[model samples]
Target: MTHSERWCWYSLLLMLIWLPIPLGSHRMWSWSIFEIWISCQTLLLSASLWHQFPWQKIRKFVWLLAPLSLFQCWIAIQAIPLPVEVLSIIAPDVAQVYRQVGADVGSLSYDRYATLTGLMKGIAYTLFAFNAVVLIHSVKRVKTVLYALVISGTFQSFYGVLTVLLNSHQSWFFGLPQGHRATGTFLYFNHFANYLVMCLCLGIGLIVSQLHQTESGSWHVRIRRWFSAVMSAKMMIRLCLIVMVIALIMTRSRMGNAVFFSVIACGGVIALCFYKRRPRALTALIISMMIIDTFLVGTLFGIDKVKQRIEATSIETETRDQAVQWSLDIIRDYPLTGTGLGSFYSTFPHYTHYNIGYYNYAHNDYVQFAAEAGIPAVVLLSLPILVALWFCFNVIRTRHSKTLKGTALGCLMGILAMMAQISVDFHLQAPANAVTFILILVLSGCVRQIQVRPESHPVAVDHLLLKN
Candidate 1:
C-alpha cells in the first residue's frame, strides 16, 4: 500500500480504538474533531492520488444528499420554533426548559444539550460523506477501509466483554463530567450495541470469505492441510461471535436484540436461497435446525430477561408515542420547514403538558429527522437505503458470485435491521450509531461495485476453475 493508504488505514484504526474511550462531555466534540481532521486528510490524499474525484457511478447519490446535510446545518444554526412554540407563547407555564430557553428570541440558546448533539451530527455527516467519496475511488482502498472496520469491531467486542465482566459503571475518565447512562464510549448502551452489531456483520463476512478462499484451494492433495487451518479459523470466529452475541444480550436493549436476530435470520435465508446449490433440501433442513437451535438456546438461558424485555416493550411504546406526537405537532405547525435542526427539544415541550424531564431527543430517528430538518430531509435520508435495496434485489435475482451475493445480502439485512430499530430508537443520532450507519453504507457500496464491475466476473471464474 502507498503511504496515503497506510495513513487512511491507521487513522481509521485510531478512530475505532477511540470509539470506546468513555470520553464524557467531550465525546461528541472530540469525535467531531477527529472525523473532520481525518476526512480533510483523506480528501487531500485522494486528490493527490487521482487528481480528480473518482467513482462517478454514485455522483448523483452524493449530490442528492448534500442539500439535506447542508439544510440540517442551516436548521441547527437557526434553531427556530415550530407551531408548538405557540403554546409557550400563550401559556408559558407548559413550556419545558428548552422552549423557555428558546423563548428568549433576542439571544440564541447555546446552552441546550440538543445544540451540541445537532452540531456533532452535522459535522459527522460531512466527514462521513467526504470519506465515502475517498473510498469510492479504489477497490483496494475500500478493502483497506473494511480491514480497519474489522479491527475496530474486534476491539469493541473485546472491550464490551471486559466491561461486562468487570461490571464497570463509570461513564467517563479524567475530569469530564460523567454521562448519566451506560454508554461505554458513547452516550448510551444501545448506541454502543448498534456499533457492535455493524462490526459483527462485517466480521462474519470477512471470516466467511477467508473460509471460502481456504476451501477453494484444497480439493486434492492439500485438502487435509487446508481443512485443519480453515476449521481452526472458523472455530475462533465462532467463539468471537458468541462473545459478541452475549455482550449484545447483556445490554438489555430490545432494539439491539431485535436487530441482531433479524440480521441472523435474514442472512441465513439469503445464504440458503442463493449460495447453497448442493443438497438443496438438506441445506433447507439445516437452516431450519440452526434457527430452532438459536431460539432454543435463547429461551433456555435467556428466558427471564426476554420476558422482562417483552414487558418493558410497553415503556418503549409509550416513549415512541410521545415522540411521534411531538413530531407531528411540529410538522403540522411548520409543514414546509418544521422546527430547525437541534430545535426539537427546544420546541417539544410546548405541545405536551406532561413532564418529560431531561429527555433531549425524539427517540425515533424518522420522527427526529422530520422534526429537526423537516420532511425534505427525511426524503433525502432514505435515498441510499432505497438504492441499496434495489441493488440487493438485483443481486439475488442474478445469483452472482457467492461472495458478492452473500455480502450484498448481509448489507441488505443490516440495513433492514437498523431501519426496524429506528422506529423506536434514535440510533442514527448518536455518534457511534451514525458511524456504524456510514460503515454499512460503504459496505453496501462495495457490494454494489463488486456486482457491477467487469473485473469481478473473471476473478470469480478463475477461483472456480482453480478449485475444480
Candidate 2:
C-alpha cells in the first residue's frame, strides 16, 4: 500500500461507510454525490496505478464484465435521441406516443432523463468495483477492507438497537415511525436487514479465514487454541456478528431473515460435501451462528416477530405479488428493448391492476429489472453474478489459502442471500445495498488475484496456507 494507493483505498472505505448513512443513498442528491465521489476516486486510482495496472490478472476477469459492459451500452442507447422512424422500428410503443404528440423525434426510453441517471449510476458502480479490485491487491488489504465493512455494520447494528431500546416512534431522518423495527440509518427495514446480512457474512468469513484447518496437537495445545480464539480479535468480530444478527431479527424482515439462514445452511452443506479436509473450526462456527444467533440472541431479541411475519406471508396478504404480476405486462410489451432503464415507474402505470397502488418499484428485483430493461438486460445483469458465483466455487474448491477459501464461501453465501431476497423485494433498488452487493460479487472474483504467501507468525501461516 503505497501512499497513493493508501489514499485510494481509504477514500473508498470512507465512501462505503458513508453510503448507507444518508438513507441508503437512494435520494437523488445523495447518490449524485456518491457518483461524483466514486468518479473522482476512480480517476485518482487510475492515475496512481498507471505504472503497474496488473493487466495479466485483470484480463482473467474481463469476460466476467462483458455482459455488464453491454448492459450499460444498452442503457446508453436507450437514452439517446433518435428519429421517430428509427424509434418506431425498434420500439413501436415509444414511437406511437411521439406520433400522438405530432413529434418527429423520440427515443426507446419513455423517460430519457431517468434512463440517463440510471446509466450514470451503473457506470459509478462499475468504476467502484474496478477501484476495489485494483486497490485491494493482497490478502492483508482484503482483510482490512472486510474488517472495515464489519465495523461499519456493527455501528449500524448498535445504532438501530439503541433506537429501538429507546422506544422511539420516529424513524431516523424521516417522519415515519418504525416502531419496533430496526432500520438503522436506512429508512426501510428490509434494506437494513439485507445490508446487515452481507456484513455478517463477511465477518463470519473473516473468522473462518483465521481458523486452523484441522484441529491438532495434545490436549493442552487444543485447549490453548480454543482459549486464544475466545480471547482474540476474532471474538470481537463474533460479538459484532451477534449484534448484527440481533439487529436483523429486530428488523422483522421475513424474506431477509429467511434468505440469510437458508444461505448459511447451504454454505455449510457445500463446505462439508466439497472440502476434502473439513476444518473443525468451520463446523463450530456454523453451528454457533445457527444455534447461538438464531436461538439465544434471537430469543432475547425479536426472532419470533420475524417468524410470525414469515408464517403470515401469503399471496392474499401481500400486494407485491400483484405488482409483480402487473410488471410482466411491461416485459411483454418491451421484450426486445424494454421501456428503458429506470423507466419501470412510468411504464408500470399502464398495466397496474385496480387493486395495486402507486409503486416506484415492482418490489421484485428480477421482475422490475425485466420490466425496466427488458429480458435481455435482465440476463445481461445476471451474467456477472452467476460468473462470480462460479469463481467463488472454484476458489473454495481449489485454493490452498484458508483465507481465500473462507472469503469465497462468504461471498458465495452473500450473493445467494441477495438473490433470494431480491425475488421477493427490490433490495437492489437502494443504491447502498446495490453497491454493497456488487462489492461482494467483485470480491468473490478477486480471490484468484490474491497473492497467498506464508507469513512468519505461526498462527497466521497456519490459518492461510501457501497456495499450491
Candidate 3:
C-alpha cells in the first residue's frame, strides 16, 4: 500500500475504535462521538485525497454509490425554503392539515431545524462511506478494519456484560440511557445488540475459515500447531464471540436475537455450499456452535427472557402497523417530497389519532425513510442495498479466496440481520450501528474489487495480517 493509503487505514482504524463510547457532543444522535471521529478522519482522508486523489481507486465502486449520493443530496434539498403553495404539492399532508387548522405550514422543511439536523447527518454518512471506500483499498486493509471492529465490539460487549452483572441502572453513563439491560455505550439495548450482531458475523466467518489442514505431519508438531491456533487467535476470537452472544441474550431483545441466529444459520448454509472442502466439518461446527450457544449457553444467560419477549410481542397492540399507516398518510399528502427529512419527529404527532408518547422514529426504517423523504427515498435507499447484496450473492456463489469469500458471506449475513431487526427497531438511527452497516458495505466492495482481478494477481493470503 502507498503511504497515503497506509495513513487512511490508520485514521479509519482509530475512527472505528472511538465510535462506541457514549459521548454525545451534538444532541441529534447525529453529532456524537462517532460523528466527531468521522469528521476528523474525513479531514485526514480528504488531505490524502488532495495530495493524490485516486479517482481510479474508487472508479470500480463509483457506480454503486449513485443511489446513496442521490439519497443524501435529496435530504439536503428538503432543507431549502419554498413557498407553502409549492409545498402543498410537495408535502400535501402537512400542508392540508395546516390549511384545515388555518395555520401556516412553513415554506422550509416541515420543521426546518430538524431537517437541518438530518441534513448534517446525511452529509456525514456520505463522507464517512466515501472515506471507507477510498482508504480501505485492499483485502488486507479490509481484514485489519474487521479485526479492529471485532476488538472494539468485544470491548463494548465486555462492558455491557459487566454493567448487567453489576446491575448498574442508577446512574446513566454520560447522561445517556442505562438500565438492567446491557446497552454497552449506546443509548439503547437494541442498538447495542445490533452492533454485536455484526461482530458475531465477522467472528463466525473467521472461525469458519480456520477449520482446515496444515501440512507439517509430525504428531507432536501438529498438536502444537493446533494448540497454538486454539490458544492464540481463534480461541480469543471465539471467546469474544461468546461474550457478545451472552451480552446479546442479556439484552432481552426478541427480534435482535432471532435475527442474529437466523442469519447465522443462513450464512453457514451458504458458506457450506460455496466452500468446496470440509463441508461436513463446517456443517458440524456451525450446528454444534448454534446448539451449544443458543440452547445451552444462552439459556444460562436468560434465553427464556428472550422467549417471553417474543411471546409478548404477539399480544401487544400492532403499534408499528399504525405508524406505517400514518407514514403512508404523510406520503399521500406530499407524494413528491413527503414531509421533509427528519420531519417525522415533528410531523407524525399531527396525524396520529392514537395516544403515544413521542413517536420519534417510526420504529421501522423503511416507513421513516418514506415519511421523511417520500416514496422515492425508499427506492434511492434500497437500490444500493439491492445492488450490494447482488454482488454478495455472486461472491458467495463463486469459489474464491476463503478469507475474502468468508468476509463477503459475513457481511451479507450482517446486512440481512439488520434488515430483519429494523422491522421492529431503528438500529440504523444510532451512529454506532449505522457505521457498522457502512463498514460491511465497504468490505463487500473491496472484496469484489480484488476478486475481479486476473489470477495473475498476488496469491490470496491464507491469514488476515494487518501489516502486509
The top-ranked prediction according to lDDT is 2
- What are the per-residue Cα lDDT tens digits for candidate 2 across 1-468? 568778988898898899999988988999999999999888887788789877876676675556667888999999999999998888888899999999898998888999999999998888887787777778877788789889889999998998999998876566667678899989789999999999988887888888877554456556768788889998998999999999999999888888888888999888877754457778888999899988999999979888888889887878988889888888888887888888888878889658567888888999988877889888877888888888888888888787788888889889988988899888888999999988897788778677777534554443444221
Runs in model 2 lying further than 4 Å from the true structure: 171-176, 454-468
Question: Which regions of candidate 3 fall more than 4 Å away from where they truly are?
Answer: 1-5, 23-26, 29-36, 88-105, 175-177, 213-225, 276-280, 316-318, 451-468
Best by TM-score: 2
Expressed as tens digits, the lDDT of each residue in 11-66 for candidate 1 is: 66566556445441235566667667666766766755675445564464564356
* Model 2 score (lDDT): 0.84
Write candidate 3's Cα lDDT for 1-468 as tens digits.
567657767877877767667531224553644556667777776776786787876777775566668887887777776656776776565566557767654543577787877777767777788888887766667678778988988888888888889877643457544677887777777888888898888777766655552343355544655676777887887888888899999888777899899998888777776654333346766886799889988979899988987777742555776777777787776666767777788878888997856688888887787777888778778776777777777776764566666677778888888889887777777766777788788777777777434332221232222124
Off by over 4 Å in 1: 20-26, 50-52, 55-120, 136-144, 169-184, 210-226, 229-232, 274-303, 315-320, 450-468
Q: Estimate each model's TM-score.
A: 0.75, 0.95, 0.88
What lDDT would candidate 1 get against the real structure?
A: 0.58
Evaluate residue 375 in candidate 1 and report its C-alpha lDDT on the 0 to 100 scale: 78
- Candidate 2 lDDT at 431 equals 93
- Sorting all predicted structures by TM-score, with the top scorer first, yields 2, 3, 1
Better of 2 and 3 by lDDT: 2
